[model samples]
Target: MSAAAFIRITRPHNAVVAGLTALIGYLIATGTLTPPSLLLAVIVALITAGGNVINDVCDVDIDRINRPDRPIPAGEISLGGARAYAAALFIAGIAIAALTPPLCLAIAVINSSILVAYAVRLKRIPVLGNGAVAYLTASVFLFGGAFAGIEGLVRNLSLAAITFLATIARELLKDAEDVDGDAAGGARTLPMIVGVQRTGIFAFACACGAVVVSLLPSGDWWGLLYLAGIAVVDLVILFGAFRGLRCTTPGCVRESGATSILRMGMFAALAVFAIAAVI
Candidate 1:
């Protein structure tokens, strides 16, 4: 494969999201710089990369229709080759986590299973698929804590729940954006079932709810700050959604911009949370 094809298959941009998840775990577990925490970050990134690869392999046909530029769909990489790469990455990720702790290994196994399931079947199941993705997104942070040997899982449950909800909101909105392609592919996403406008509204509500949940006393003022920041971003996204609803064509540029803003805002929040934990 050419260099560009390799990059496309790896989906380097998406790796940031996985790295951020590992960062969350490191912060919650150590609250300070440590070797093990760094290792956990690498492990999480590997796992996330593997998951993305597998997802691409599974969605090659749909991607050929909606995102023909993607590696597998664009014929830059064979589906079989992508599957082999995914399997290797998944095993490597699990091995790395296993070195950290038993709990980390267990979490890794569960995470791998969930990703496989989503790629194989759950991804076509509408809200359930979205929920599963969101749940896994939240689990990244929790899994980080496990790798770091953090005690009292309950202490972080609230934060995890908020993150899960926020991710779910984003996932739903994304589905709404890709409704046309998904419909053609026979995928029953939220927008396919409830219409794009309703899905947009529901996504906005979920984002608002996530912000509210973050405001609850979680003993982390910094986390609250992150939530407040997220709320501001969400408001902007809401306005964009409103515009999309009113416009005849629903500009893809506006929707993409809103999603980018949300992602950046979430990363900012995670950074703040990490800083707060250390201080």
Candidate 2:
């Protein structure tokens, strides 16, 4: 396989971002940066890369219609090759976690299983899929906390909750965006089952919940800098929510635009978290 195809299968950019999330969690728990935290970040990245590749392998057929440019769909990478690559990464990630705390090893194994399940089946079942994604996102924080043994419980939980809620919102919006494609693939997403308008409302509610929870972290573990940064993030998130709310009917929502805005907001929120954690 070409190097580009291999890289494409891993979705390295997304994996790196997820790894950074683990680093954030580790820093919060330890209240300091260290080599062990870096190791945890690397482990998470490997696992995320495996997950993304497995997901692509599972969806190769669907992607032929919805996303033909992806490596597998484009025939740049074979499904068998992708599966083998993912297995190697998962084994590496779990082995590394096993070298750390026992809890970390358990989390790695569980998360790995969940990722496989999500790619194989859970992701076709609407809310179950969204919850799976959100839970995995939240687990990044919990996995970090496992290393240090509950020292940063409150902050980590708050971070996890915020990530969980925001991810649900994004997942809901993404389901709406992919409704047509998912429907063609026989997937039963919320938007496909309940129509886009109601799905939009549900997504808005989740986003609003995340915004509210984001505020709770302030004046406690975070200071004015965090509040200031979070306020901007909140505004961006609210923009997405407001746009989502305006979708009063099934066809009014441009799910792509809505999904994009929410993605930006979530990344911005993460940035705010990093700023708060240090400054």
Candidate 3:
């Protein structure tokens, strides 16, 4: 396989972000940066990349219709080859998790299974598919926390909740964006059920939910600095929501800008979380 094919299939950018996410959890739960934590974070990132590859494999036909430039549809990577690569990555990631601790091992096995199931079948369900993706995104926090012996779990859980809701919002927007491809591929997504404009409204509401979740607990855990940083995060989310509200029905066919804003906001929120822990 060509290096470009492997890179395209893995979506290295997302894998890097996944690594950073695990690193944040490790730092939060461990109370000190450690080499082993970093290593485990890398392993988790690889597993995420593997999941991306499998997703591409399953979406080959849909991608050909909606995303013709993708590796599988573009003829840059074979489905069988991608599957084998994903399996190897899953094994490598699980082995590392297994070596860490029991909790880590359990999480790895469950997450890996869920990844496969999501790509193969669950992704065709209506909002349920989005929920599965949100949960998987949230679990990254727990995965890193498990490595730290479960200390400071409350904080990690809080972060996980924030990530989950935020991810749900983004996933919904994505569903709206891919409605065309989904329809061609026989998916029963929210947009297909309720229409694109309604789906955008739903996505906006979910972002609002994330904002509310972020504000919970008052001053019990976070201080003014955290609140201040979260304000910026909330603003970013609000912008995306506003755009969703303003965009016409046809606009829902491609929510690229709104979706990108949500991703940026998530990264900014993570940064806020990391910074506030120290300040």
- Strongest candidate by lDDT: 2
Give per-residue CA lDDT, model 1, range 52-163, as digits (tens): 8999988887788779989887788888888998999889989887687787788889998899899899988888898998888888778877765656244456567767
lDDT per prediction?
A: 0.70, 0.82, 0.80
* Candidate 2 residue runs with Cα over 4 Å from true position: 66-69, 73-77, 217-220, 223-225, 248-251
Candidate 1: misplaced stretches above 4 Å? 1-7, 66-69, 73-75, 150-155, 220-258
Clash count, predicted structure 3: 0
List model 2 lDDT by residue over 1-279, tens digit each.
688999878889999988888888777666578876787888999999999999999988878987999998888888888999999999999988888888788989999999999999998777998999999998998888778875554457766787888889878877776676666667788887788778878888998898889888432447677788888988988788667767744345664376678778878887777666665
Query: Local error of candidate 2 at 17, Å?
Result: 1.8
How high is the lDDT of residue 238 in model 2? Answer: 78
As a whole number from 0 to 100, the lDDT of residue 165 in candidate 2 is: 86
Least well predicted 10-residue stretch by lDDT in candidate 1:
241-250
What ranking of all candidate models by lDDT puts the best one first?
2, 3, 1
